[model samples]
Each structure stands twice: as structure tokens, then as C-alpha cells.
Target: MSQSNLFIVMSIIAVISSQPVRGKDCVCELQNSESAFPESKLSRVEITALECIRNISSEKMTEVDRLVLGLQHRLQQLNENVSMLEKEDNGNLYGAVSLRIIQLELAEIQDLLDKLGTTNTNNQQLSTEMADQLRDMKYTIAELENFDHTMVVLKDQENQRIKRHLKLCEEELNATSPPPTPTMGNCGLGQMVNVSGAKTYSLTVYGTSYSFGAWGRDANPVPGDENKYWLVVLSSSNVFGHFVRQYNSLSTILLGIGPTDTHISSSNPTTNTIQGPNMVMYENALYYNCYNTLNVCKFNMTTRTVTNVALPNDAGFNNKFPFAHLASAYSHTDMDFAADESGVYVIYATTSNFGNVVISKVETSTPPVLSQTWSTTLHKKTVTNTFMVCGVLYATRYLDKDTEEIFYSFDTKTNTERYDWRIHIKKLQTNIKFLNYDPRDHLLYVYSDAYILTYEIMFR
Candidate 1:
């Protein structure tokens, strides 16, 4: 070992020893060539980086929340729209418009769902809820689309039915003789000039809760049941009825005595039940609008059997052309069974006739065929009620709570119509749900707001 080398080695050892020993816990201070690095500057940079990351995360979350809230609001609106459509679905006539509206809303909802899915990709729970709501809305939209298709199919079927009926009507008219004209012998009462005030007024035996109903004596009664009176009180929201109450006489009904007989039309609304407030008792049978269909039903009191005949397919039903006024509309009152001196007639409105009044002569034979049909220029919705007297179809309109004016008339025998007749009929209530003429008694039986009223028809 040389002396200079040994001295160099000792100097290196001392320099290394003077640098200071460091433990695991000791922190080293770094420096640039000129000075030590600033601790405050490093701390500030770290804090700024953390704040930036936090701000970015918060902004993303806010966007996601906004999307979720918008989606929820849209879903709520869609649900309300569906509910409204269900409520206004009347015989599928207005379904097309409703379906279109629903489809548009569904499209908007789908767009919102897409936005939500894109904006909130990280939240699994929120994403799941949104997906579920979207799926439900899709299902609802599918149902509405199906309903639209069904309406189309049903319309097609109805068109076919109308063609068949038209052909049948032509054949029948050609086969039958010319309809009889109104004469003194056939109809002793001349033209209806006026209607007297209520001769008989009484609430229903079932109480005022009935609200809608009909009451009249049989126009063509059986030999022994000449004085028999029939009542049909609508139940179930004033839309459906399943029974016909009978009384031995007008005296009994006016006295509110318990019914002598009760005839069951059906156990449920699905079967052969009365649908509208308009009904008539002719001979030993009760004629009315059949349940949920455009048919005239003949329910025999003796046999307890129901027979129905489909009206003209163009005939409106299920409130399509219901009897309406400025204040309210009578639901399910499309088919009005009216008995006259001539025979049983059904008065209704038809779409083909531009919602005008249509009168059809219904033969009380097996299955009750429609023998003759007449279309009038009178709009059926404008009239509150109608009745047949001596082969004349008379329409009435509301004047006030206590009066109804006979403003229109259509003579089936002459095929003539008059619209300026202002024969006013006094009433006990504002709404007359049912008004029918009994040829046997020569009286007008009006069921008005759960009240049974009878009026005498004066002729000229």
C-alpha cells in the first residue's frame, strides 16, 4: 500500500461519514443546483391537482342527476297520458287520435332514456330503474299500437257487415209490400201538436240512486197483462242493468209499491243485459239495447230467453252519437227502442248518414229482423230523446231543467222531415234519460233523473 493511496482512501471515508446517516423514517430534502425545492409550491400543486379531479367528478354527477330527473318527469307524464286514453276510449272511434298521441309521447320517452343511459353510465342502480321504466313504457306503447290495429280490423269487419246488411235490406224491401201510411184508422191520434205537463211523476222504487231508467206500460200487451207496467232502472254507473221490474198497474208503480215480478236479463254485464236507459215493453217481451254491442235485444218474459238482431253496421253505439246537450251527454244511449201504433222501431244515428237520425222497423219475429230503414237529416246528437208515435219519429231537445221542446219530426210513412216544430214538453228534472211512447195508453213515459213521469200527447 502506497502512502498517497492510503491518504486518499482515508479522505473519502471521512467525507462519506460527514454526510450523515439516514434511517427509514428520515426524509431527504431535494434541491436544485442553486437552492432547495420549495415545499409550499409542491403542496400547492398537489392540492390543485386533487381539486381539479373533484370538480370534474362533481360535474359529471350533476349531469347524470339532471338526466335522471328529466327521465322521471317524462315517465310520469306518459303514465298520465295512458290513463286519459283508457278513460276516453269509446268504442275505439277516438282511439286513432289517442294512439297517435301516445306514440309521439313514447318516442320522446325513448329519446330521454337514451340520453340517460349515455350520461349516467356509472350508476348501476339508477341505470336499472331507468331501464325498467323504459321497458314499461314500451309495453304500454305496444298495447296501444295493438289496439289501433284491432280497431282497423274491426272497422274492416264492420264495413263488410254493412255491405251484407245493405244487400239484405234491399232484398227485404223488394220482397215486402209498400209500407203503410198513417191514417185515422191505424193511428186515431193525428199529428202531435203539443205535449201536456207531467200527469204522473214518481221516483223509482229502488230510490233516486238509479239516476237513469225507463218505465212504461206494454204497447202490445198480452190479454191478461194489459195494465202491466215495466221499469228498467240502470245500475252500475248508470250504464248497465240486469233486471226489469214489473207492476200490476200504474197505480201500483205511482204508489212505489214493490214490484209484482222481476225479470233477470243477465247475471253479469257480459251476457244479455240492458246497456242503455232506453228500453220498451211490447207485448210480452222487453226490447232494449244489448250489452256492449250494436244490437236490439228481445228478452221474452214468458220463456226467459234472449234474442238479438244486429242493427245496421253504420249505426253508432257506445256513446259515439249519444244523446247530448250543452251541459252533459247521456252515455250508451245510441239505440232508442220506441213503440208506435205501427210496430216496434229502433231510432239511432249512423256514421254513413253523417250522424243523422235513422229509423228502422223491427219485426218481432224470430231473431227480430230489421224490415225497413229510413235515414233523416236530423242530427241525433242534437236531440236529447226521441219517440215513435203513429209511425212518426219525433225528436226533442232540452230547454231547461223543467222543459223539453219537441223541435224535430220525421214521418216514416211519408219520408218527410220537419225541424221547426217547437212543441215543448214540461219535465220534472233536467235530464231525461229515457222517453218512449206507449201506443196502447197514448202516453209519453219519460225516465228523467231517477224520476218516472207520464205525459199525455195532444194531437191536431
Candidate 2:
């Protein structure tokens, strides 16, 4: 080879080596060993490679920015939805429906979050903000989901049943003469004004394994059973009870001694079994929600017979509108039984009334018919529990893990309701599965997470 050709070859090799090598692209033209290499071609190849890298980097950054902007817009919409939900939650008549919509929206947000997480980006601050917003929205969804509102999905059969019940209720109300104005009856304790803190707290005579149950004396006991204390430990799925354990007195229950168990059913979850943790002993019989049905069951402890009366088909049951709080829901607590000085009553919510509390007077007849029904404006989902005192329906809400606020009331006697009451009651546990006012002693009995707590009711 000529010396000049060798120098040209060496120069070509150096220029090729120095230029950036973009993946799988031709950076320089191949030439014969005797041909002179073009300097402009080499310069163009180097410039093209650098521009390619810059363009690729710019495109990636733009994509990241686009994702970030989309995420920000979605987060803004989510915040608005959350704010609207909070504003509309006061009555929350349609809370379950609203929550379902929110759930769908949350799923979309989650999908976007997942997409954002897969992207390669260097904007740590924007990424962190998005992550935080998604997390907070998820937490809100979790808290709302705890309401157990999934039962709001009414099957066709349920819808028909509810319509029929509504018709029956309407016909009954029209057919019968208006009921006499309710009176306070023998309740000498004027209108209930305040409820004292827990006067006593004791674990169940059974154990903590049964996390949900009820214990209280019969509000209207027969001659010899006045002092009888009945304990019902839900022995199946923390939602059904097959027996009642009777203690001779409060002292016996306190000492965890002498509970005579009476089986209400052969199996734990069979028919005629107690469906929920709410029940009340009144006049030698146990009143409760029947298993797998919307009927109130009356079990006469005396005869061992069960008689059930169907509630309005619109009634919420099977955890449709159970008492709930921010953290959890006590399942199957749709039908709450209470007894005031007047008679036994069943408190529940109905779909026709949009999940507002409905109070029905249970006539202690041969079959225990619902004689009169009163609807209240208080939303059942917002309340943790309800009880009756002197024909007044008192509703409670969760204040904290250790407290409950009796914030609203509806007087059946006057068909009037109040929401400004601030009566507070302390709790032994975070959740109260069952609470009822027993007029026998004017005391509030609370079944809280397998523990029993009692409070005194003070009147104005």
C-alpha cells in the first residue's frame, strides 16, 4: 500500500472509532481502501447520532410529562368526588348507591396509578405526589367499603318483594283507623336527656371467641322471671345464635356462673335460629330476626315454639343497611329489637324509605303482627345502634373507639324527631354489636365485642 493510502486508512479508522455508535445504524459509508474518505459524511454521521439521542430523550420526557398531567387531572376529579360525597353524607339516604359509583371511580384511579408506576421517569416530586394522592383515595375507599353496602344490589326478586310489602303497608295503614296517639305510659323518667357513662363492664360468661352477642334482662318479664338475665352468644359466623343462656340474676352473670342454656334450634344456622346479634327478652319470649328471612321471630321460652311475622318486604336485611362506622360493620344487624315501657318494637331500615330508620310496633299477639309502623328521617347506615325509651326511638353514632354519641331521636308519640341531642356513652370496646334500652331498670345494655357494658339513663 502507498504511504498516503495507509495514512488515509488510519484517519478513517480513528474518525469511525471516535464517532458515537448508535445501535444498529450505519454511521459512516464504506469506501475502497484506495478511495478518499469524505470528512462531511463523517461529520454528518456524528451529528445524526447525537440528534437521535437527543430526540429519543426528549420524546421520553414528554411522555412522562403527559402521564404526570393525566394523573394530576384524575386526582383533581377524585378530590372533587370525595368532597361531594362528604357533603352528601349528612343524610346519606343514598349512601350505598353513591359508594358504588365511587368504587368504580376508584378502580379507574387505581388503573392509572398502576400505569404511572410502570413508566420510567426522573420527576420524583411529581411521582411522589401522585403516589400519595392515590394512597389517600384508596384509604377513603376502604373506609367507605367497610359499610358493607354491597347488599344494595337488589335482585329482581327482592325488588318485587319490596314492592309488594310497600303495597301491603300502604293498604294496612289505610284500612285501619289511625292508631291512638302514643303516650309515655308508665315511664316516670321524663324525656331521656342524658345517658351516663358505663356503670359496669363485664366479659361474657362464655368467652371472647364469640365476638358478637346480647345480654339483658327481659324488659317485660313474667311474674317469676323478672330478675332473669339472658345471654345469647352467636355461635355461628358471629351472626347466628341457636340458644339462650339464662342466668338467675345480674350477680350470677357478673360472677360468670349458673347459665342455663336453652336451644332454640337443633343446628346453629338452621331455620328459626337468631339471624343477628340483636334480640330482646320481653314477657317470657325472645324477639329477634329469623334466619334467612325478613320476618321477626318470637320464641316463647315457655313453650319452646317459634312464631314469625313478615316485616315489610322493603326492609333491609342480611347486612343491607347494618349499623356501621368508619372502621368496620357488624354484619346482619339489620333488625334491632327494643322494648320500652309500652311494648316490644323492631327497628330497621327499608329500601322504600331509602335506608332511613323505620320503627314498627310488634303486637304481642298469637303471631306477633306489626300493628303500627313509623318512619324516621334518620339514615340507618349512619347510626351504630338504636333503642327505645318511652316510645322514643334513640339513635347512636360512633364517636370514637371508646365512645358513642346518642345524637338523634324520634318520638313515636308525637311523630316528631330531633337531631341535636349530644348524650354520650362510654364503651368497653371499639364496636358495639348490640345495644338496647331495657325499661325494666331504665338501663342501657350494650354488647360490645363479646363484652357487656351497662349504662344508666337519666331524664330531664
Query: In candidate 1, how many clashes are counted?
Result: 1
Show where candidate 1 strays beyond 4 Å.
1-186
Residues 310-344, model 2: lDDT tens digits: 99888989999898888788799898999988999
Q: How well is each residue in 45-159 modelled by candidate 1, as lDDT tens digits?
A: 4565555455456446556555555556557646755775676636876567666766976887788788778665655655575566556556654544453423776688799
lDDT of 2 at 112: 66
Q: Estimate the overall C-alpha local distance difference test score of candidate 2.
A: 0.79
Q: Give the least accurate 10-residue stretch of model 1, judged by summed lDDT.
A: 25-34
What lDDT is reached at residue 384 by model 2?
A: 90
TM-score of 1: 0.59
RMSD of each: 30.2, 26.0
